[model samples]
Target: MKIIRVGEPGLERPVVVDDAGTSFDLTTLTADIDGAFLAADGIATIRRALAEGRLPTVDVSGLRQGAPVVRPHAVWCIGMNYAAHAAESGAEPPTVPVLFFKTPNTVVGPYDDVLIPRGAEKTDWEVELAVVIGRRARYLDSPADAARHIAGYTISNDVSERAFQLESSGGQWSKGKCAETFNPLGPALVPADELDAGNLRLWSRVNGEPRQDSSTADLIFSVDYLVWHLSQVAVLEPGDIINTGTPQGVALSKRFPYLRPGDVVELGIDGIGSQRQRLRPA
Candidate 1:
């Protein structure tokens, strides 16, 4: 099952598309896909509604697709979670997860325009597997506790400005990550039960040229471990997002030119879905 939102930015209507591509209006079921809905067992409720044929079918033919979830209170990110990515950045893979943040407002519709902040060079793209928290988690006993708390999976383009992040961060990475439209997430949010994130082909393309091409299997820190580890330090609230780090193909390694206005970025993760964005000056 894929949960989605369609329409203009602030007026997006909640929707759900079944395996057969039947679109159902979630307006009667909930106002929007947010923390309240997920925490209240919204996915299960939607399943039951779908089974009962109780919701109306929506004509989403021309509706714009928005980020699957509302702006999360916290957009948590993991850095260098992929071994090759760590190496490319000139560092050894960490013995533990490296954490960072992107302000909640950075979340935008999957197909929305991405802004290249003025005077910024070294803007980069990262194709990452994003985990959405469905239940409040804190001090989880083990990685096994992560599954139940995960509401679903989605694709996130962890956009960055390498200069702000590494060169001018004063040791803080969020300096580069927290820009408007920095995070393009989802064409759909697939329920966690329906997919196995352990192994999936996730890749990225910039201006039609292949950039990042890798699998989640290469992750130095697995999904469950990152969630479990983070819960020990912060409360993983429903609707919060965890960007499980990007694979090695980002421009940060200096293998390719950084993003510029007019460039197009496309990212995809099998099963979850794909997203594309056109860059323009902010």
Candidate 2:
């Protein structure tokens, strides 16, 4: 099922796109799509109803879409996970997974405007694959076991500011990552069970020109392994999001090209959905 949140930011309602492509509001069952529903077995109940044909359907055309998950506990990220992206940034593949976090306040709807933070002259774009955790996890044994804990997938633009990330405070990456409105997630949240996690393709464009284009096949740490590894360090709570990192082709990797007001950014992944945003001066 294609799960999504719809309506205005902070006031969104849970919804699912039914078999006929009509939107069936899940508001009657839940208020917002978040960690609680996953932990409470709401997903399983939805699946059973869908199988039994007891859910109602409505017109999909008029409703606006919101980020699939609301109020995620944290937005976790992995850096330089793609070999080519690593090479492009003048770095070698890391011996261990590189992790970072984006404050939950940075979350915004998929099609919302992305701000160019004040004094940010080097704003950049990164098209990334975001994984949503479905249940509490700790000390998982292997990738296969880790996979079962994923609730779904969504498209995310891991927008970055190069100078703040690489030059400021010597080496603190969060200063560059925690900007408000930095992460635009969800045209829809696709349940992990419905799609092929290993083979999905991803690509990004800035103002109608192609930039980053790569596949999940290039990830240095597969989704399952990262989850397994993270669970060992801290309890993996439901509603926490993991941004698996971006592929090469960002402005930082290029000798020229940085975002300015009015620039448009777009990206998509197969089976997940696509999103486009207009860059505006802050």
Candidate 3:
């Protein structure tokens, strides 16, 4: 089943799309799809409610879609997780996970406009598989224990400004990463039990032309490993987000031009869903 949040910004109502592709109201079960709800095993509750016909059918036609989960406590990002992405950026693959953060406020709806930061010379797009935390994770004993902590998965466009990422700073990535509307997330959040996060095909397109075409199989660091490794260094609270890094084909590689106003970017994963965004001036 896929969890969806719909309505105007900051006022989305929780919804669920069942295996049969039916949309159901989750208001009787929960007010919103957020950290508090996920921490309480809302996915399981929703599953049971649907099976029991406790949820009412809802129409999502012609409505605005919000990020599947709202106001996450944190948005964590992994860098150089794909070997080819590392090589393309002139960096060697790290032995350990490389981590960073984007301002939580950067998160926006999948169909929202991504603002091109002022004076930005290298605004870029990165399509990544995003993991949402369900349970609190701290110093997990092993990668095998990570499954229970993950709520589900979705799509995230890790929009960036290359100058702030590389030239202006001494390689501090967040400066380039956290602009208003920098992260466009979701269309749906597929429950972990419903979708396999590993080995899925993910790709990006600009104006209908393919840009990034790769699979999670190309990741040098797997999802389980990233969760466990991160738990050791930081307390991962429920509703947190982990952007599992992007594959090659980012403009930072100097092979393609950076994003400009009016550019249309479409990114998708095989099963979970896809998202589209229009670039506009900040």
lDDT of each: 0.94, 0.86, 0.94
User: Which parts of model 3 are misplaced by more than 4 Å?
Assistant: none
lDDT (10s digit) by residue, model 3, range 108-170: 999999999888989999999999999999999999999999999999999989899888977
Give the Å error, residue 188, model 2: 1.1
Ranking by lDDT: 1, 3, 2
What tens digits encode model 1's per-residue C-alpha lDDT throughout 1-282? 899999999999899999999999999989999999999999999999999999999899987999999889899999999999999999999999999999999999999999998779889999999999999999999999899999999999999999999899999999999889999999999999998888989999999999999999999899999999999999999999999999898998888999999999999999978899999999
RMSD to the true structure for each prediction, in A, is: 0.7, 1.3, 0.8
Candidate 2: segments with Cα more than 4 A from true spot: none
My TM-score estimates for the predictions, one after another, are 0.99, 0.96, 0.99
Count of residue pairs whose backbone atoms collide, per candidate: 0, 0, 0
Return the clash pairs for model 2, or none.
Answer: none
Name the 10 consecutive residues with the lowest summed lDDT in model 3: 190-199
Give model 2's TM-score versus the native structure: 0.96
Residue-level lDDT of model 2, residues 1-282, one tens digit each, is: 788887877778887876557677676677878899988877776777777767787555666677889979989899999998899899999988999889998888888999999999789998999999999889898777997789989988898988899888477788888888899998888888887767799999989999978899989999998999898888888999999989988998875499999999999998887899999987
Pairs clashing within candidate 3: none
What's the lDDT for residue 239 in model 1? Answer: 98
